[model samples]
Target: MKTDNSNIDDLREVLHWIRNLVTGRLKIHFSQIDDYLVENIAFSEETTGLASFAITHQPTFIEFAVLALSYVPHIQPDFFNKIIAEYLPDGGDFPEFGCVKGTNHRGILPTGETAQFIIAGDDIGKRIAVQRLFSSEHWFAKEHVLWLEQVREGEPAMSGRMIMNPEIVELLTLGTVSKPSFSIDFPAEHIETEMDWDDLVLPETTFRQIQEIEQWIACNETLINDWGMKKRIKPGYRALFYGPPGTGKTLTAMLLGKQTGNEVFRIDLSRVISKYIGETEKNLARLFDKAENKNWILFFDEADALFGKRTDIRDAHDKYANQEVAYLLQRVENYNGLVILASNQRSNIDNAFSRRFQNIIPFPMPRPEERLSIWKKTIPQQLPLDMDLDIENIALRYELSGAAILNIIQYCSIQLLADTAPFLTAEMLDAAVRREYIKEGRIT
Candidate 1:
């Protein structure tokens, strides 16, 4: 059966058939298999063809079977178990994959050995599947595949645990492949927010930078294909969004993700730092490994965790911390996708990290015009505004960040709703602003 471009079921059918084909090897001939399966392999029931994404670009059923077998335990581990099942009484044949001599366990890469096996029938039907697969472009490089395969074998390298990219994991298990992007793992217990571009309220310079970011994202694929570039050209697509808290650095990141059709993963350094040495690097490695090959944007909030001035070697901790920073530099430089670092203060970022970034757009607090926009957009409608509520006057009265303006608007909406007020008066808004000031610790 040929499958559609992404014929998941057809893909499964090919693998299952291959599974049975390999299993039949236990017996001297394919005829020994169940009649139902035997007949299916015999020209099958009007084979349906599918277009597969195999490296060879061949969509034949045999090509799909080859791909299914090559990925090994990385995909359909259960199926591999069945294909390699030991129906034979045992003559030193591994029960896991029933190959007597040459068999690939499908780790990061093949063991650089041919996985030769007999394909049923007579002695002349010997074949080497690994030899063919090694000649193709695996989903991951052999080294990376080997690393993962080793890690799975319970002998993870000192580099700590790395994992298959999420997209790969989903493809193997769920039969679905997603566009490349980053999303937070709920188990990680990190709070991040995403918003549309329209939702962001920022000063003109900041908005211009966001537009530039959008343009950069649009040109990303062209930069690779047209520029003869595997990595980015000089002035890489990295950015530093520095601003006071609530000036929309985080919001801009979400907007960028939405605009670019990529998943943006926000990492909070405050939550990521660990007291244990090497744990931080392990976590960061895991993050990078997961993001690799996936079209994703890494948004690091409170990046001073990695960018802090290297302290004089006061102790071993200091030395390791510097190593962590160095590791970050290398990863970011090599990362083929986008990386955005946000900080409350530009001065807080280390010169070393900041120097490498291509864009360093500072977010300034909203001015009166932007504040007016924020008030108009955030304030809910149908709340009776006391004819006395003057939006222009409120915007003029307080020099507020977009965040602070939203907070006051929220308070005003709640107060009006709670009191069943017919109109939201200037007095109520003024009171809300007062509460915001107090909340900011401006007064007791």
Candidate 2:
């Protein structure tokens, strides 16, 4: 096992910086956690902290020998003596690894350079602890550290790599030591954080499905990493939320993005479908490319527009429409992020694309119990209520979509604002409901 001197130096520096950050003696600015750290950390206009990166390295025979010699001397004498005398009488506790030869399988170092460090652990906890020790202050003595020490920008502080042995690849991690770097240019285009989930009330089953998506993100990080490494194959999660319009289909799509740290980009098929040959496919290509690069959730609200039935070649138009669906099939298969398609008419979507879905959740209309819950939740706390106003009766009679219910409530409140009584009467509530129904063309 042979350790690179520069890497060793980097490890030392990183340990020192970590101690500074934890102790408050040094200011540390982390771009990833800027929202929380901006208030405490300090940096000049020219200096910004390093971007942390991790890698795992397997020790060579020479590298392992050096680490044992270097770190062993620093361990507490009691711990060192107990193992060295008793364990090493024949060699050491299970014979400290890093003592294999590249060609000759004997000794602590394959090449026996005696400078490499061998970090071993029986479990993930110990491995992670070892990584964090170097990542923080335990490895660096306080006296050797200075105040206001900063991590250098663009310099990778951490590395996570797999240590390849015959049967397993043990994960190893390390860091570098460098002063912070400054950004040469500010981003010209910035994302607006104002995007929020819609105000549609959801059923318990629907809410649980959304939560499952979040859990999947946490549990499937490794799968995502693997997908990222694979080229050409667009890796995206497919979800089908089928329900009637105004039943919270699009709202759920936005909620998925808002909750999962992804941008939700709704695909407008009106803009995507074209009369020109190959134009529809070209539009889809562009849409997928941008969404993939930005890690956005490409949402197809009213999926029937693009994913509707594929017509036979009745004419050139019909042929192009079929081609458009074919193009979508290819692009979606390769997309490596979340692609959500919401349709009021799920039956309209072609079977060719339906098979690609991993999760197809039916977004049914709110049941009576669910609607009762929505009505209770949507009422404003501040709105004055007349004891005579029967909200339960209104909810039962209208059986409206959550959006419509909310709108009706708002309309009722406004209409009653000038009245002496703050509570809405049944007559007023009925009027509000009638107005909403007429607006939706449910009545002429």
Candidate 3:
């Protein structure tokens, strides 16, 4: 079944009311003319139910819109034509000079230069009109559509409609709602992890770190709304996940996002880093600007490449690199949400950068018992195992990371699948282990 988007229709209904009210005002003001402007209500009953909704939600909004739209000719003439063309179709005519009426003008049309001049010209009258209309509803406190500047295409321009901000417009027209609205677009893969908290295999201390962060996320609202304001500490949480590849850094990030119910974005450092001066900051600012207010986690994987220790200022490149690092650190510190930075080498990250993080959890190579558990979990227990198969012995003998063990299992499983009696063999397992070591140049 298709979902009915009532927000769109409710908005159109409100537009109809504004069109009605504005046209009614036009008819009264221009009553001396023989052919007074009128509106054609071509919209279906299902689409535009009545003017009751706008009166309840935004009574002064339409009145202000009428006043604001008068300036549309000055700022957005093309947009104004697009709006009025609906009532006064391309064939319809509204004369440039006195007393000429549109043949198809069903309602009062604000299409003439006179209407534009009158609306734009009356500075004092407009002020009094604003005060008269919104005496009860404070105009300054309201989120009026006339003020917000949105990008028309690639450049910034004001979208002259209420509740039709760029984000909502994208949501209505396109399926996806663009975040931040700073960069033309963002390049980040949204990852959904299949691994849960229970599937993770790491040291007890590291697991405790995960628990602490999880509890913090769960109590984040309480901390901010209840405790954080009292203490004056920032609400954002920053953590560093450092270890060798395949020791569960990425999986932990994925699981954290899944657990928190907040959307996670993994930054692409390649795109963010630029050779030109100030371009890097511009891109970073755009990303962070969009990220603000939304409770989203930003995962910076392979972050050592960007947040590494500052080099001696022997050259311009070195100076800029340090500046880039400084810029990133400042943004992270100011951001009011969770940021997880993962790196293979903790030493590569500057002490200044490292100090900002609340937790610096180490993901060491899985110990023998943990490796045994990882091995067991990688394959289903229901799969037949040979009498010689021993995950514990394999775990003890080979100093393989959690990732390496999975790779070895995959290698042996594929080879066994082609055999007459498919089952794990000690010889096959040993061969796979040796192959993995050789592949990594550890046993070459």
Q: Which lDDT values do the candidates have, in the order given?
A: 0.61, 0.53, 0.64
Q: Which candidate should be chosen as best, given lDDT against the real structure? A: 3
Error (Å) of candidate 2 at residue 244 is 1.1
Residues 115-229, model 2: lDDT tens digits: 1122322345644544443333632212111111233576323221111121111101122222112121110111223435444566667777877777765555565566574
Q: What are the TM-scores, per candidate, against the unseen true structure?
A: 0.74, 0.54, 0.71
* Ten-residue stretch with the least lDDT total in model 1: 107-116
Residue-level lDDT tens digits of model 3 in 1-444: 111454345445435544454454444444533233333323232332222223334434425454334332322335334444554576455443111222453333232233332232235565455434323354421323222222257631212121223442333223235544213356455666877888889999999998888887888788778664736776589999999988998888889889888778888888888899988888788677657667788888999888888889999989988898999999999888889999998897889988888899999988889988898888766456789788789888888887888898777767767674478878778888999989989887
lDDT of 1: 0.61
lDDT of 3: 0.64
